[model samples]
Target: MNSSFPRLVEAVTLCFMSLNESCPRTVYTLALRGPLYLLFAVIVILIVIGNLLVICIIIFSQHLHTSTNFLVLSLSVAGLLLGVVVMPFSMVRSLETCWYFGKVFCNFHSTVDIILCNTTVWHLTFISIDRYLAVCHPMEYQKQMTNRLCVAMIMSSWSLSSVFGFTITLLDPEIKRKETFHMNCFGGCFALHTKEIGVQYSIIFYFIPVSIIVTVYSRIFFVAVRQSKLIHSYNYNPKAPLKSKGFKATKTLAVVIGTFLVCWTPFFMCNIIDPIIDHSVPPLLYEVFMWLAYLNTMFNPIIYSFFYRWFRETSKNFWERLLNILI
Candidate 1:
């Protein structure tokens, strides 16, 4: 009776184990435990919480809500969504061999992955333009980027990105969608862009945006460096303050743009090239590149904390206040 009772308890515990806990052994050399999963978990947490902290600081600190900083806040919000909505699904799809989230969710997840990522890119470009106006045309910067206009620009950015991403991707005919992206059998769920679809999206999302980012930042760097030289060479002057401040702001944004490019370029390259190469890239390699792109969302706040002095100060104060309330 004692032995039978122990066995009955063990059987009940096995039946109640999580779906994830019941994964069968595989021949794939995957580490779903220990260091690998831990690292992925950390990345997701930092991306979500770091972006959230940025949003909180921006919301609470009225001074930080300038036209340019508003653009930064928009990007951070996109990053927050990327981490909260996109990364967890990607992580599960990467770790597990099955797709239990249903077909409707598969479409929703794929669409959102594209939407949030596209929005982040637009915010980066607009932020660069804002910095440019501040550095190159201070008098006009105030006149041009009014608070109402900034709000309008933010709305336009989101609307344009969604319209572009969703419109282009969903325009593929019914048969094509089934052939490429559909998850049919409760098995692995990953968005596989067909060669035609890949080429179309790469041009729309990648090539054109890369051209804009490069062109804008190239001019920003030249103007910022030239102004920084003048500021350093002179004694205290009235114009010196504005020039120095604008140059510092440009520098901070330049780092942010550079980091975004570095983190996302690999995925962009692989994504475009994979279709051209008949999707010859190994699944694991593709997954690595994709996660590397997601890591940009994580790196955004780290870049801000490192380079942006106002953000650092505000963050410090925000944390202190929260700690005091908790204590």
Candidate 2:
């Protein structure tokens, strides 16, 4: 599956390259320039700032270092790597409209991309399961979500993501080979195959994770609503001790899940549609959607800040200290 997938990607890449060369002077190419540059800048800045804030919040605030927070921190780290290591390459690819970085860099770039992408989804999956346990079975959550287990889960997530990503690197030799600059170099056979692989990836990396998140969060919402109703019924008293906190936390989780869905849905939808639709999508359109998926990394920290007070406060403190040093 690993080797075959890259071959497929390569084939698809060649097809697209052919189409791109043939249509270089088309309306699509002319329309892409300004927006693509703007998108590149915006996405890079957002991802850098957002992921940095996440890391700062996690690092400086000792109280925020719970097992759940650790998972979030790991996610932030992956996001940071994606922003720094992956986004620049994507920008370069967009500007050049070809893989000028040769085969080795291409392989490494793709490897990093896959690893980070998989890590993001897997982290979300792990978090959803954790939240489910916490909300549905509080006693068991307290027991099972120990520091040791948290570490193990994190390690497992990284290891599993790495294994899948590395498999792709090992399977595709052409991924590491520099191709001659033929007109067909942009999107030929290899490119078409890549497109198919992208569609399949939407199923593997996106649809499955989304399904898991939706199912888990749906159950969580139902449970929380039921519990809230029960609490309200039992206590005619105006002040219910846990009501506010529980409600706030549930709302925060909902926002987190919602942000993930919003950021990723368009990209995945494009992947699914591009394969079915025979007409070539504008390169700029693909670039826009690609950055949209990349925006997921940037939004996580912002969502955390908005929804979680501790993260917001910690971020403020960290920035204040940095400014103090600068001053």
Candidate 3:
């Protein structure tokens, strides 16, 4: 009986052995655990390095300093901060099912996570608006999207995101009381939203932004297609320099929007539905959705590399200069 009691206690391990308030730990098999760690490590490394390259390229290459690229830079900066400030600890917490960083750091981490991710979404929405002007109203685009105006948009994006982040973190239910359930015990960290809050959050953060992006891009795509046909039919180059550039940029950013939708829609859908269904969704499923959303940042740089000649050329030149300095 004594030996069996020890085995039972070992089987039901708490994240903090000495603390009764600690959440129970989840134990995974070695095979599953090894690959999960390796995958997250690779994702974290890629997200950091990829966004860093984007930031350096945009900052150093002065010719790329247009309104469009400024917005792209803002997006990249948000992704970089997510990778550096929020992701590593999130990776640990997600995999281990425990928050070892304590309640204070956990709140800080959660707030930054919301801010960065929300900022990225806002950046995308603004970029879509910028592209709409360029492609749909080329004559007014240059006059409208001035450097000062673009900076203002960037600042507004960050400010709104900051407000939302802090407000949401302050409103987290876990901050006010301990959970009786195993999943949300003291060592476990996650926001607990009621059905009403979940619906409101999803509507505000996900649905509204996504709706704007899709509507604007739908207009941009059809307009581009019609313009292309008209240009080809004429067999003579019109004053298409602005239109051509805008179309290409639109195409690249359309891919970005599409990728963002794919990666995040599932998570947000679950976010809304889980609370409606009394939070019956498994914890592991939430972790998987969250990580999938995180992977979007890593993919953004890869998308740029594939689609943007400027990205490829600047990257090649930048690396060459570094190699020359080293040699």
Select the stronger candidate by TM-score from 1 and 3: 3
The models' CA-based lDDT, in order, is 0.73, 0.72, 0.84
Q: Residue by residue across 1-327, what tens digits does model 2's lDDT show?
A: 346432211112332344545312222243455676787788788888888778777787888888898999899899989989988878767664556565567778878888897899889888988888888888788898898988887888789878867776676633332233242343211221244466666777888888998998888888888788778778766675546445566777888888788877877787667646642555557767777778788888878878787777788888898899999
**How well does each candidate superpose onto the true structure, as a TM-score?**
0.82, 0.79, 0.91
Rate residue 317 of model 1 by lDDT.
96
Better of 1 and 2 by TM-score: 1
lDDT of 1 by residue, 1-327 (tens): 355432211111211135443323122333333456678889999999999999999999988878877888899999999998888878777655345586567667877888888788778777777777777887788899899988887897799878866764466322343433322333444553566666766676667777887888788778877877786677656555445676677667778877888877887778778767766787668888888888888898898899877888999999999999999
Candidate closest to the true structure, highest lDDT: 3
**Full ranking by TM-score:** 3, 1, 2
User: Candidate 1: worst 10 consecutive residues by lDDT?
Assistant: 7-16
lDDT of 3 by residue, 200-255 (tens): 77887899999999999999988887787676667765654434565677788788
- Residue 200, candidate 1: Cα error in Å is 2.3
Best by TM-score, which number?
3
For all candidates, what are the clash counts? 0, 32, 0
